[model samples]
Target: MSEKVSLLTARIIDNRRVAPAHFLMTVRLPLSFATPFPGQFVMIRNDECDGPLLARPLSVYGFQRQQDHAVMDLLYRVVGQGTSLFSRMIPGEELCFFGPLGKGFSIPTGVKKVLLVAGGVGVAPLIFLLHKRLLPADGKGIMETIFYLGARTAELLTGLERLCGFCDLKICTDDGSRGYHGPVTGLLKHDIGGFDAGDTVIYACGPKPMVRAMGNLLQDAPFHCQVSLEERMACGLGACLGCAVAVRTGEGKTDYRRVCQDGPVFDLRDIVFASPAGP
Candidate 1:
């Protein structure tokens, strides 16, 4: 932590329901704080105490850094208490947060093609990546970016409207409410051929199962794939070690690594997804 952690006094800029079960909120961070990178998360507190137990970790959706002004956008789903509070925040209300925490998505320096995969709320972080890195310098980018977004319905898919300025986007909703009537991976399989395998990269963030599914889909592909891993977190820091993930090692073994510290973003090949036993 910095001696004086930049106390960003963020006000709820806009709170709107984008999907049946999803919401998007924009918060204006203090101008002094640095802009956050894609795949980075923020620890939000509904109240300044332990009552809420722990800060809810959320991916940074996108940010705007203007003359002495910084604003961060968040795409959240109301799945729990912390997020519920986030959904209810009024436009003028204030909230406390700590972040730009954890490592973020890595964009290849000379990559000629990029594929961004998003699942539900997982789309949050990718928005930041596309806006800052993929957009053209003079308002048009050098690389071709293809966005693959998946959801059950058109309403479940959020945030693509803004990305139209940067990439060629494709949508897939299971219920046939939007573009393609199938999983986003379906689009990847058909469209991925347009780019060179060696020169392309895939950055994904979403539910655990989807990440695993994506891993399976890209197993034989030559392109590099990185998936953002989500774990049940207590302390957004490494102190708790509650967010450990199993990683494959060079010795043909597996070891546990902290998700909060070692990564929130990881190379797809590094993770070992084991099946859970139960009913």
Candidate 2:
């Protein structure tokens, strides 16, 4: 019940300049706060406390809900110290956000094929689960999402052309400049072929060694992957476990999960990564 702190009223719909430190701001919110799902996150602050007074989560890239006004979208990348002070905010200037914080991205009732792996700015919360229609290509739906999306060039793959009307999108770039060249787990080990594993349901975010290499390429690929992690959080909530991680059990034993309230979304065979000075 600590996840409801509205105060939106934002506005900045498009602040381009994508690449070379990247910047793509788009805001419009006012209402729509009914549990901001789809890999939820938001907890901004660029002022009202001198400067970086904590709160700068981001993600949750799209949300509409109209009937007055309710927009939630953000795709930021300026990096270092609270987004370089939110890249010197302008275009109307009035941000002091609260969240649709933590826990989200798991609405695939029944599953047919839902692969969404992102890297670099983690494609901002999988573009809010591809616009939350929950996959509806006029087929009655139970889940059929596809999106590879990677980055390292082509200006860090900014927003991928607004997600190309949801899913079945792919792109990689390490040095080839755009769309399929190298890393993106080497284009998911040469195009996973519509992903196998009984029904498919892989989800991923980014960096942490590409979400531990998409959890070791879904460990034998029977589908059902999930991951969304990034460390260095202070307290996105879960009372400062300081973004703990390292679950991995099944007699292999290794527990300690709490990336801001039990997860930043886990279960890619339940994480493990810690090493490098070993926590």
Candidate 3:
């Protein structure tokens, strides 16, 4: 860990529901803290201490650096006990957190465009990636980006309006509650052919099935692709083998990688998709 990655207490600036089941929690960090890159995560310790036992891991959604203090935001859903607990935290509450941990997405030095593929709350890290830095767009080194978001309903499209301001957005809701009436992956497949594969990159974060599905779809493609694997992680520093990903090694050999340390971000080619078409 670096000098900045300490277990620190943060003051909740705001915590509110942004969507049907999604919530946004913003905290003010110490003046010494640095903003986390996209896909990096924080371990939020429960206030009850022993009830939930371990802290919940959340990806950095957005952040802003101030003259003295910095503010970081976490966008999460009320999925289980850990997250359910976070949903109830109020402003002014002190939350213990340790983070800016884990590997993050990597954009090539020069790219024509970037396709951000998000599934529901997966929008969290991708948005952070966009806001954290700029990617080289053309030979002249400009940047261009677009988002392909998928959800079951419009209500599940968290942070859609905000993301639109940063780049072009194409939405797909299963029930046709939003922009397109098909899966988001369909949008990616439809538009990916427009750019020069060598000059384009795809950055994705979502459920395993979606990531797996994308992995399968792009396995034979020319574009460089990276996917952030989501897993139930314990001991974010990699002390325990709590979060492991199946990786392809040799001809048929398979290995496991710890998501908390080695990556939440990984090359799409290295992963062994559970489904031929992925998840």
- Output the number of the lDDT-best candidate: 3
- Backbone clash pairs for candidate 1 read 136-140, 136-141
Can you give the lDDT of residue 226 in candidate 1?
Answer: 82
Query: Candidates ranked by lDDT, best first?
Result: 3, 1, 2
**Tens-digit per-residue lDDT, 1-279, candidate 2:** 236757554666566667677676766676556557777777677664476667777767777778876766677777787887776676776676767767775745666777788887788888777666455556344566778888988777867776776567788988878889877877886778656677777788888778777767666766677777766676576787877887876787677777766667777777766555543
User: Model-by-model lDDT, in order?
Assistant: 0.80, 0.72, 0.82
Clashing pairs in 2: 39-105, 197-222
After superposition, candidate 1 runs with Cα above 4 Å error:
1-9, 48-51, 275-279
Candidate 1 lDDT, 180-239, residue by residue in tens: 998888777777667777788899988887888888887887778888888878887778
Candidate 3 local lDDT, 163-253, one digit each (tens): 7667888899889987888778877878766878878888998887788779777867877888888888878988888887888776667
Candidate 2's TM-score reads 0.33
lDDT of 1 at 162: 74
Model 1 compared with the native: what TM-score?
0.91
